[model samples]
Target: MTPTPDPPATLCEAFQRTVAARPQEPALLALAGTALTWAQYAERVASVAAALRHLGVRRGEPVALMLTNRPEFHVADCAALHLGAVPFSLYNSLPADQIHDLLANTAARLVVTERRFLPVLHAAAAGTSVRYLVTVDQVDQTPEEGVLTLEEAEARAPRPFELAAALDCVGPDDLVTLIHTSGTTGRPKAVEITHRAMLSQLSGSQQVLKVTDQDSHISFLPAAHIADRWGSHYTNLLCGTRLTCLDDITRLSEALALVRPTLFGAVPSVWQRMRTTLEGALAEADPGLRALAEEALATGRRHAPRRWKGVLTQAERKELDGADAVLAELRRRVGLDRARVCITGAAPAPEGLQEFFHALGLPLTDAWGMSELSGIALIAPPGMPRPGTVGRPVPGAEIRIADDGELLVRAPFLMRGYRGESELTARTIDAAGWLHTGDLAAVDAQGDIRIIDRKKDLIINTGGQNMAPARIEGVLRESTPLIAHAVVIGDGRPYNVALLVPDREAVTAWARRTGIATAAPWDTHGAELAAAFAGAVADANARLSRAERIRVHEVIADEWAPGGPELTVTLKVRRAAVTGRYADLVETLYRRGAADR
Candidate 1:
């Protein structure tokens, strides 16, 4: 059973209480062996607060952070909270123009970034409200006019301010942070998170996740993302859980093995890559080992129960234990041997990925939430997760499907409003205080919510039949290992078509084996690649309805990445942007079909 969490009036109170309770316990760990105990972390927060105060940061003012997932992010965020200031988070990889726009929107005066981004920051800060730029790393050249290193600022602090008085000024209703939406459909909007909303989310998650002090977490997601901020940062601070900060996301698998975290949270993309990597490793194992592993997985699936009610019979426990033993090496190899709870959110996961992990005795739970909710509104229970559903509504969050099939949620942790967009916020949040989530979803008989797709992304063909692009995209990607992403396009067309992004490495391997003489797989226009993709598309079409079937597809040469116009910072494809950019290619696919007709 989960213990009732002690509610703190403000974030600072939570941090202070945790530090007082576990002063010697590890609070933060970096990839480079930099560790800080709770007490040490608090001392740094105090120093940072003093520095901010010395720099004239007043209460309620926005202090932006453009740093990566490092210890300083926590320090600076907590420092802002300690000063009763709003911490505005910015993705480090965002283009300079976007950064400038956000800074102007928030009127942020001070931004903390790394030395490597100095030039970009400088350009963005020009003619904006930004007055000071602080670097977390050492600079090679002489400092710019308004630039200062964190170490220099800390050394120059006159004295540590009295935090108790500052804490007294902070209240539950005070604005805590400004988190931006992913902007997959359009421009990013800043969501205003308050102290009360944040604490409410922490309480709700605690009831569901049952996170304890003994559990450790690897913080690898982008720090600016609300999932990382609310799920990882706030949860760790409030629960007194040890958090290991990952510097490089590319080395996440290595970090996972080294940290062996008990609680892990990630976006669906990260989970997908991990799954692909594990499956690749299994396929390359010795034939005997591979056969044994497959048999173990099969047995585990056969014995796995549908739901867990927190109690098990002795025989059932023993059987599960045996299955765990059989697949122990496979779990160790995947670096989830010690994980108790693994969660994926921010985007829809591919079908069967959750079940695959569950067969291995690891419940890869799917969750659903947005920036407006402060944190997750729905989370699949550890052992009782339904494959396609995103579980039930969490405590303090009431969910209902609107008449138009939109999901409406009334949560205690809903954002106060969208910053500088009261009209838009009013439209989004109804007078009854329910947030009208733009997602088209359905509540199953068991009350689990299954998101179909974004309302705007829904495809209505010329035949007036509605289809979900996300469903088709997921099927196409899951049908073959070579396909990385799929964007189904048939909004008002005769038939559905798709733009597919191939997995370059997988394509290269196939090309090598098939004798396709091409230096770059992405650049290759070989018949083998086309045939392989055609086979994959056929597999996907076999499962889809006639109206939803992808009739034709063209594989793109370039991969969609963040910082590109077509992909958001969280890597969600901007459907409109992609279609607009590849208008000619999409037209060609349809034009060929018309010619055939």
Candidate 2:
């Protein structure tokens, strides 16, 4: 008979083991000018655990966190896990109605939030299951009923609370967190993640990245997202790496220069902004400098290793060395000079953007995963990423194409199920334990997964030809710096049309250079601007198939953003919402026999 393997350890147990071994190591650096060693952080976790216990938080109970990407978020998350409580993360920007809905759904006992969000929480938690409102920041107003500050909680809790026995009670099967989906289609569903799944994901990340204690990271993404929680927070805890928490995401470009992290992860939108900034800077540079930078990038690309299998020849190395100054300056500008590995995920990035980063000596590799996976399942190997492909599956993850062309994954890190949605969960995960990913994917000969598009987002034209709108949108955005966002519309239609959102800054700069008087981006809608957009559409059309080519396009003046009806918190465009809002504009493109622009 085969021997049975030891059961997986709980997240709390794993964290304790690391803390015991590296008590003196720097664990977290807060942007507020405070740093916590492993020992100090563990102490805080214990204290927070005691406070929660005093507050009557029990095993399997949900403790909601509505804070930003701060050290307190990590502390509260770990503290809840220490006592086997489930940590439910809530976006700070969520409206009162959604907050109330989620709170009612989870039946959260306590909500840890800051003062700025107190008004919303106060309204949402009224007559709900919430027993207490734990504020992280102090406020001038008197404490309301059931509201207590973090300091007050700690003061009431007994000192030197023992956590070993409580942690030992936690098992791998215990629910670790309840992460909600982005709800792009409809209401957000809570995904039940387990300790075993999170641990498996951390193990896979460790195997692929080989991160060490010397490596550093900065947390700027929303902590509510699984990619940030599992990929950055939990990974750092398990690896004994230093993590810096950013106070404001708007200052990320400046933070990068200060933190100079060795490992960084961001969505495609952030990468696009960086690329646009760099391009704009280069375009404004002197002719000599521009030429030098271009030559350096070309040389870097020529000498860059493929699949981490090639070595640069001595002559090529020498040529690259000559451009080191320019390369270093460019890298410093983007705050990636020290980045050994930079990853982009959540949404697919343009192939051109990845190639541009590669040419600049920064391998911005593509990663693929969803909230249901607990963490990323597919990440390009360091120094060996293949452009346009979200690399092969990580260890312990099995990926196969379904009969209907959807990607099916059987992974140890898959979520337990959707909380309070048994019917939906059963429909998602089959009897064979395969999680049906709603993405259409194609595996190359090398086993790399190239995602085509979301199965439901596929646009079938009147000619019976299927086209991926995401692919076309990616191409459209990459073709011109002026285009910030693009949505291709042609489902069951005669031809494809596009709704484009222009980059306001880029357009304003162009107008200034061309001596066009414009008060704002919308004011500069002259023949010149029209020609620029038309040129961009033509360029994108040249690369697409005849049937997939965008025949007509219109530019929208208003910018799409989070907190808007047409966008999710992560800034993903809601197709139905956008189409409905601009229904007349879309109809005009197809109805009036508009010229191909």
How do the residues 1-597 of candidate 2 rate in per-residue lDDT, one tens digit apiece?
A: 999644338778767777887898889897555488889999999898889888989999999999888888899999999888999888877889889999998999899889988899989997789989998878669767889998789889875567687666888899989889855684789999999999998888788888988899998888888888886788877778889999688889888888888998888878888887887788889999999998988877776654144577677778878977898899999999999988998887899888888888887899999889988888888888888999999998999899889999999999999998899999999999999989999999987899999998999988899999999999999898788779899999989889998877678777776677776446535678888899999999999989889888888888886646777777677888888999998899897545542
lDDT of 1 by residue, 12-56 (tens): 898888999999999999766648999999888889889988988
Per-candidate Cα lDDT values, in order, are 0.84, 0.85
Per-prediction TM-score, please?
0.95, 0.95
TM-score of candidate 1 to 2 decimals: 0.95
Estimate the TM-score for candidate 2: 0.95
Runs in model 2 with CA error above 4 Å? 1-8, 32-34, 305-308, 508-518, 594-597
Best by lDDT: 2
The backbone clash count of each candidate, in order, is: 0, 0
Error of 2 at 555 (Å): 1.1
